[model samples]
Target: MNSNQKKLVKSTVPVLQTNGTDLTKHFYSRMFKHHPELKNLFNMSNQASGKQQHALAGAVLAYAEHIENPEVLINVLKSIGNKHVSLNISPEQYDIVGHHLISSIKEVLGEAASDDLIEAWTEAYNELAQIMISIEAELYQSNLKKEGGWKGWRTFIISEITEESSEVKSFYLKPKDQASIADYLPGQYLSVKLFIPALGHEQARQYSLSSAFNPEYYRISVKKESNGNVPEGVVSNMLHHKKTGDEIWVSAPSGVFHAGVESNQPLVLISGGIGITPLLSMLETNKKRLQENTTVWLHSCRNEKVHAFKDNVDRLNQDSEWLTTHVFYETLSQNGNDSVKEGRINLAELRDEVLIDDAKYYICGPEVFIKVQYDSLIKLGVAQEDILYEEFGPQLLHFN
Candidate 1:
């Protein structure tokens, strides 16, 4: 964009800072009204909780704040673009979104939406859209060229459903066409799409692969998210209700959060609650290569009843001395349980066990858990580059 357009975009930063969420909320409502079919592609649960709106609002504010140097937003754009590829977002839809977004800006601003301002925003939106399209095109091509990968959604048959815990269930999925499955990185996730009867539309949710990569099948363990007060999880509840011999749609695994399999650095895996999914994959993948300086897994959950994959961790421990594990339960049913600690996994308390020199740490959990662990690690003198974290939803963390 030209200098005048940049100035126009920058001038809206104040308005966006104060009214971004309202604008995005209105934008989504208007866009969905005109393009109802797109409902199938969105996570209705996030929409209901207003997380999606909050995420988009943050993105808009970030864009306006960095309008003069858009390259500064490259990481954010790459993260979003990878997700878009997993969702099979097409280029044509960009036009629809741009039209609605600009229209929403006009509608929200009312008389303040001058022609010059709208024109500048139009150019800015087009530029961002093109960047996304180019990035997604490259991602699609790369995934398509992989040996067992395909673009868009592929049919998968659930061959088995193993109840792992009171709240989590593991589904063993095999390609219905009997095609070989792609080998995904240990920390990667796959998008699963299914029809929600209540919503009368399909909804897609990303679930981390919970086990090591297998050529024959892929495994995803889902924690049912119904806690009475919170809205019922459409996809998680549906997956829990499903039985053997059921079918679902799955996209190729895609995620930037991953452990370096070839690196010999000491690995620290910290997880809380249901966040253990992807970290479990990384641990399982490294099981065979465990040495004295292998991987360490520190996990925390509500109690033994909700703890998943205990047997798997035990069996892995028996195989090699490389996998060291420490389990913490917030509310243990038995006080004398020798195997588990009765408290949250506090990094400060376990500084000796963790904080190894030259260790690469991977954490996954709720926002609070991630922030706590990240801050603790930083306080313990760990480099920011050495700490990797994965959030279930949008990329909201901005590291300095």
Candidate 2:
């Protein structure tokens, strides 16, 4: 874009900071109204909860503020590109989104929206969209290059369903074509699409691959969301009701949360509640890879009733001496509760034992859980680059 176009995008930063969500909300409203088929590609639950809008708003504001040097936003844009590729979003769809977004800006800004400003934004949006399209194309090619992987969605059969806890179940997915499956990083996830009958359209959700990568199958442990009214747990509930041999559309595994296996530093996997999914994969994969990294798992849950994968962790530890497990039960108020401690997982108190020199920390769980642990670790003198966490939903998890 030219200097004038860049200036036009920069000038909109203030308005975006103030009314970005409103603009994205209007964009989605108009997009879905005109193209109802697009609903199948979005998580309606997130749409209803306003998380999708808020996330898009943050993204827009960031892009506008950094319009002068969009190259600096490559990392953030790549993450979004990963999601878009997982959903099999096509390049042609960008034009539709751009139209609705430009129209939304005009409708929201009213008389202030001049022809020149609109023209500038049109060029600006196209530039970003092209960058995104290129990123997604590269991602698709990367996945396709892996044996047993392809672009877009593939049908997978639920071969086995194992009950892990009162609220969570493990679904073993295998490609219906009976072909080998590509290996994913321990902390990666795959998008699973299911049809929501009540909504009269399909919905997709990303679930962490709970086990180590293998050729036979990919495992995703899902916690049935039991709270709230209709549509709250719609997709998960539908998944839980599905019997063995049922088929679901699945995207190739994609995520940037996993750690590098080459690092010989100590590995710490901390989790709360059902957020243990991806962390579990990390722990399991470390064993399969036979890495020399000394690993520690610090987990907190309400009680043993909701604790998943306790046996798997125990068996893995028994087979080898590479892993250590620590548990904290929230409801335990007395001794002999078969837990290491009570209340939430405390890095400060356990630092002496669980904390290792030159260790990288991986955390996953609720938003607040991640924040508390992140803040605590930082206060304990851990380097910011050594700690990483993944949020479980469509919401943007940011720390600044």
Candidate 3:
């Protein structure tokens, strides 16, 4: 970037850091007023909670912070690019977003927003937008070049359904044309889009691939959330309403949460409730690869009745001497049978039960669960570089 661009980026950082929320609220309000159609494009719930708006503002500010050395922001850019691709956010939309963003900044900063400041922000936005567009284009090309990957949406027909639990069902998806699906690394996710009549247009959400990568089909286990207030996960709820042979739109696989098979160190997989889906894929993939090493799988669920894939884990443990599985049940049934543990997975109990030193840890679950596990891992002197995580929501902004 030129010195002028660098100056612009540096100047805006403080403004964004201080007034980002207000700027985002103003930006969204203005954008929606002009383009009411885009209201459906964003997560209204996230907007109401102020998470999505704050996340976007934080991202823009972070991007500006590294404008002089754009290479440092590659991973951040890639993550957002994947999300945008899933949301089907078009390049044209960037122009719309940029205009409102600049206008909001000017309106918020008032006297501080001089002619030079406006020019600098415009230049910075253009530069960042160019970077995003180029990166997204590369992602599009890579997916298309893959054996079974394609651009835009493709039809996947539900081949079968297996009951994982009373509330969870696993759907096996195969291309309607019987074409092979892209082979993804364990822990990757697929973006599924649904056309909701009430909401209009299409809404997309990412679900982790629960089964190991196979040419025949992909599997996703979804738990039905019937909470009276908040709406259930859009795509998941839609999938639940469909029957065998129903078709849905799915994007090619993408994510960076997979285990690093290249490393020879012991692997530790930690999960709670439905978070077990991705971890199971990793374990299954390792089993298929015949990777014999000390691997620990720690899973926590409310009770045995709701735990999915117990049989699969049991079979893997019996077959592989290197695999050890631990199950923590939060609610034990009546009678002191100890058949199910009666409380949340105690980090102290976990540390006492399992040895984690010299192992790479992968954690996934709700924000609070992940936070507890993460703090415990750090307390145990685990290196930050050795621990990785995948959040179900937009909580990446808080990470380093």
Candidate 4:
């Protein structure tokens, strides 16, 4: 974009900061009204909860904030691209979104949206959309080129379901056609699209693959999110009701949040609550490598009943001297295991295990859990580059 166009976009940063969520909420309502069929591609639960709106608002604000150097937003855009690829977002749909977004800006701004102002935003959105489309195109191609890979969705049968915890269940899915499934990194996630009879439209949710990669099947551990802390999870409840031999639509595994298998650095895996799903997969994969340096896992949950994979981690801990673990429960855990501690995680308490030389830290959990860990690490002098995280659900994917 030209200097004038860039200035126009940047000038809207203040407006975006204050009214971004409302703008995106308006955009969604307008878009859905014009094209109801697109409803199948979004998570209506997030729509209802306003998480999706908040996320888009944040994205737009970030774009305008960094309009002068859009490349700096590449990481954020790549994260969104991963989600877009999972949903089979098409290039043609960008035009539809662009039209609605520009229209929303015009309609909401009223007299403030002069012809020049509209032209500038139009250019800015076009530029941003091109970058997004390119990123998604590369992601689609990567998935397509993988062994046993295909674009869009495929039918998978629920071969097995086991309750991992009081609130969490594991579902082992095998291709109904008996075809090979694409191999994925241990921390990657796959999208599950299912028909919600109540909504009268299909809804999709991304669940982290809970086990190490296997050619025969893919597994996802889902937590029933009915705790009233967040929006009630419609898909999680429906998934819990599933039976063996049930079929659901699943897309190829996609995500940017994965452990670097090529790295030999000592690994630190931290999780809170249901965030353990992907980290558990990472833990399992790390166990197989048997790296020379010790591996540490720190997990926090409300209590033993809701603590998933407790035994599995314990077994791995017992079997490998290279592995160490720490568990924290808000409520007392009567398992009488030395690994269990009462209270939330404190990095200061376990400094020796986590502050290893050149250790790579991978964290997954709620926003607060991640931010606390990140801040703790920084205070303890750990480099920011070494701390990586995967935010759950449709929210700001980046940590401040």
- Model 2: lDDT to the true structure: 0.88
| Alpha-carbon runs more than 4 Å astray in model 1 | 227-231, 289-293
Residues 248-330 of candidate 4 have per-residue lDDT tens digits of: 99999999889876678888889999999998888787766554346788999899899998889888888888888899999
TM-score of 1: 0.96
Point out the worst 10-residue segment of candidate 2 by lDDT.
332-341
State residue 42's C-alpha deviation in candidate 1, in Å: 1.0
Which should have the higher TM-score, number 1 or number 4?
4
> Model 3, stretches more than 4 Å misplaced?
1-8, 227-232, 261-263, 335-340, 352-358
TM-scores of all candidate predictions against the true structure: 0.96, 0.95, 0.91, 0.97
Off by over 4 Å in 4: 227-231, 290-293, 333-336
Query: Which residue pairs come into collision in candidate 3?
Result: none
Counting clashing residue pairs in each candidate, in order, gives 0, 0, 0, 0
C-alpha RMSD of each candidate structure in angstroms: 1.7, 1.7, 2.5, 1.7
Question: What's the distance in Å from true for residue 157, model 2?
Answer: 1.1
Q: Which order, best to worst by TM-score?
A: 4, 1, 2, 3
Candidates in order have lDDT scores of 0.89, 0.88, 0.80, 0.89
* Global lDDT of model 4: 0.89
Give the C-alpha miss distance for residue 233 in model 2, angstroms: 1.5
Candidate 4: how large is its RMSD? Answer: 1.7
